[model samples]
Target: MTAAAAATADGAAAAARARTAGGGAGPAGAAAAAAASADDDPFLAVAVPPLPRQLSAKVQHAIISADSQLSERLSEQLGLPRPLILELMRFGAVHYCPVMPKAGPNTPMTPEQLAAASAARAGAMARWGPAPKLQVPRRAMEDAPATAGGYARVHLQPKRFPAAHTTDWRRRVLHQGPDCVVVDKPPGVQVSPTVDNVLESVPACTAAALGLPLDSLAGLHRLDAGTSGVVVLGRGGLAFARWWCGLLEARSGGGGSGGGGSSKSGGKSGGGSESGGGSESGGGSESGGRSGGRGPKAGNEAATARAAEAARAVEAAAEAAAATGGAPLRKVYRAATLSPPPLGRMVHHALVGTRRPGEPAHTLMLAVPVEGSAYCELEVVQVKPIALTGAAAEEFGPSAFESDIRLVTGRTHQIRAQLAASGCIVIGDLLYEAVSARAAHEAAAGERAAHEAAASGRGGGGGGADAAASSAAAGDGGGGTAGGEAGAAAAAAASAEAATAAAEAKCGFAVGSAATAWSRAAQADPLRAIGLQAHRLAVYDPERRLGDGAPAAADLGPGWVEFEAGVPWWRA
Candidate 1:
């Protein structure tokens, strides 16, 4: 190997050794080791070729120009740091191609190389196929101080995130495999940190649980903070890519034969039959073996029946595989809301991002009322990869409905936005315009307060005579104002009891009980009381289909597994 490559290998080996030695120290030690092991160690440095002085000068000038006050302002606007912006520019890590403006191939450049480089870039772009690009050294960029004008689309690397809150990984793991791990992500836990916040995320937590390096874990998809559900994480880049592709295929209805919409229902039916056959076979084998004196004809018939069942099982497995296009991904969710939805299947068609009509998005909603009240309903919403025509700017009206949402397309805030647009907001979804449950409690409290004040006023008015009589009695007994004060205290205590009873009736809770405290707490923060109950119900992996037999762990493919996180807390 070349000297540079060999040095890089050595550095990597050193890092591995450090990690192994410090494994007991946990994530902090791993991070420290990585930080200390620089990719280019001066001791192992090789004689690398240097950049031409003229080109270097041009790059330096470009970096100086880009890192200006203007860049800082742009960085703020873009929600990126000023230093990051400069680094991106200096390293040419930004998306745009950097080219010299105008100088010719044989022209003798002046002392100021910036002007020449700009001239060359302009001339080259004016003429043709490819332009002479300006290259910048990464090391130079790293050492450079923050300047102003440099701006680019900053792709920030994931940093070592400190766990923001305590999380139970054992409870979270729905399925774990060599290629991936599926977790029942709790609400309020972020999928990943953003530009501003470096809070703990699902991937980070997964890494901790598995004792793997953070960089080794890749998040295949994301769920919103309020959305509690199954989150899939790939063990590595290759695994993540494969899983992501499968998810896309499933979403796009690219899976052959069984349109993506029908896969869930089909799988359920097939699974039932397969399960039934296993039970029947088990019982038949025990009975037949015990009653071993059957005639040849009877034995032949039983064998025929077993063979037929096996054939059916094989057929079913094949059908499932064809239907799912061999993709190992299925997602289902359960949501809760306040208002009752219109029962049955309803299709919601709209554009995803910009309101201006584009490839219209489609979300199929199936509403079923939750048994209890007319105000609440349970919906099973199926999102297909199908595109519908038309603008959904004003398609749905304001109504409350909870949903069992199955994602057909893994879009950002797909469930929340679609449901909100359809007038069925998930409970505790503050981002959307759903009516708050707290409003009703506030109104009730106001009415109760008014009633109590009026009643107290009436009681005070009526007690005046009693007070005067008590004072007269006290004067006769030589007790003075003390007797009047005692009488006043008794009246106040009676009023307080009456007020408490009235409050119990108003709040629909027993006085001074746990239920009363809970009611008060609910009124204080309705969001917590009635949380966004979106849970991942089940996930199916079609790639792991069994043929006429029970599936063993070895039969499962890379990134292949099924998981089910039961109904959300509200449903239970």
Candidate 2:
């Protein structure tokens, strides 16, 4: 019978057999015999349906007589039981040979399942081993090289760190308390010269500048190259160690944000939560409900309380930072941009919290937008030392436009992501400038190739005329870097021309009524530096915004103006 038909027939036949068995078991001695038989006979008791007509009798007979001598003999020969052998045979008849299924496509087995089946077959083969053996001849070992002891003694040069600076310049100190120093670091330099002794970098430079012995000075902290700020240095090793340990502990507790827990603070000294905390507020409690009132009581109140405690801890660290000199050193920054900021634009962003000294941590962020941009920017200045806030929430609510940020923590790559996430990516960013650079490169190469190709043919034609004019401009203009005479001349001329063009373009910007007023005010006043400008991007800032809190254009002041003064070597 076909498989489906066979299945149906087997079911009917099995039902009939059960009825017959049931009726046969009813009388006097028959009941006892049937009960005993049921205990020992698997096939008679099992509920499995029968197989196809020809196969069913043989399979059932094998199972019914599974404990008989014939069954034992068959099982010994097959390495299994009589019932298992019969079932295998029945399955082979139905499916062992390849045949198309009802469906057009074949069903696929999972790789793992297929592999497991293959492994099972292998195990079976192993059980009845013919003991197949194969040999792989081993190669003879070569004699050890002569003078092995001498070779081992040869010293190797210390490996250098790629893309990292190294110098013999180093200074060490031992101190028992906090100390600070102002290092005269070069503008195009990094505070940490090498990873091994991060403190050695700026301190070494400070030693050199002060004409102090190399072993006398020690650096406690670092500043970004473009920052050019005072670096707090400690004196003896013990003292420096104490300060370092305290600083480390403080930052880890989410109290002072820097190096490690950086991105969480969003560049604010007294980072506050939406509910208020840290240098600005206390922790473990919610700010008195605004007009919004209290949220329903759930297990969540504990979580809010915990958040508040964390804020208080952060504030403690800020207090520690401030109290170092009886008061923390105040820092100020100036940024120049393309135009004046819009009338009144302020954007608030949330600063996520990070790990404590003993815990592992990460930052969360939200960006909000603000007012304006011809070339949008903002200046980050460390305002003052304030009491710590220990309230429940540490971040601010979202706003409308893009915003620039300062760093409260020293986490890596925070500032770059923060600015980009806020919507206004910083100008002239190397790592983040992929799209713009690629386009510019393609365009420049195309123009150069076309110009060169044109020059190669037709002497004194369009190319010759252009070439002469270019030569005159390059020779006369003083606007580029030092190279060979022709190269330098060209570079110079290009630099001058670019600057002039930039100024002209911004002049065009001044035609707008808002910008025109800014220009007029600048021309009218001496202290007011007017016109559009760009920033000298710096490294050391790390904090980014995420989610709905990105900065808005409205945050930029009146003219959307910002600018940079000194050249920057390090980047955010």
Clash count in backbone of candidate 2: 92
lDDT scores of the candidates, listed in order = 0.38, 0.29
Model 1 vs. true fold: TM = 0.38
For candidate 1, what's the RMSD? Answer: 22.1
Q: Where does model 1 exceed 4 Å of error?
A: 1-163, 192-199, 237-240, 254-328, 355-403, 407-414, 434-534, 537-561, 566-572
In Å, residue 161's CA in model 1 sits off its true spot by 9.9
- lDDT for each residue of candidate 2 in 490-549, tens digit (9 for 90 to 100): 455456445444533433322222323223322222111111111221211011101122
Q: What is the per-residue lDDT of model 1 for residues 1-572, given as tens digits with 9 covering 90 to 100? A: 34643454445435434433434455565444444422232111110111011010111123223333433544556644444444333222332223333445775656576464565445434544342343221222122233322212333322222222445776677766666666776664455433222224566566667776544554444444445665555665342333343343443343211111111111110001111000000000000001112234555886565445434543444444456465334445655555544444434432222211321112222233333211111235532222212221112223334445544433323455445555556555443331112223334445444444433443565345454444343233423354344554455445645655564454444434233342343233211312243353222344442111222333344333445565554443
Highest-scoring model, lDDT: 1
**How many clashing residue pairs, candidate 1?**
23
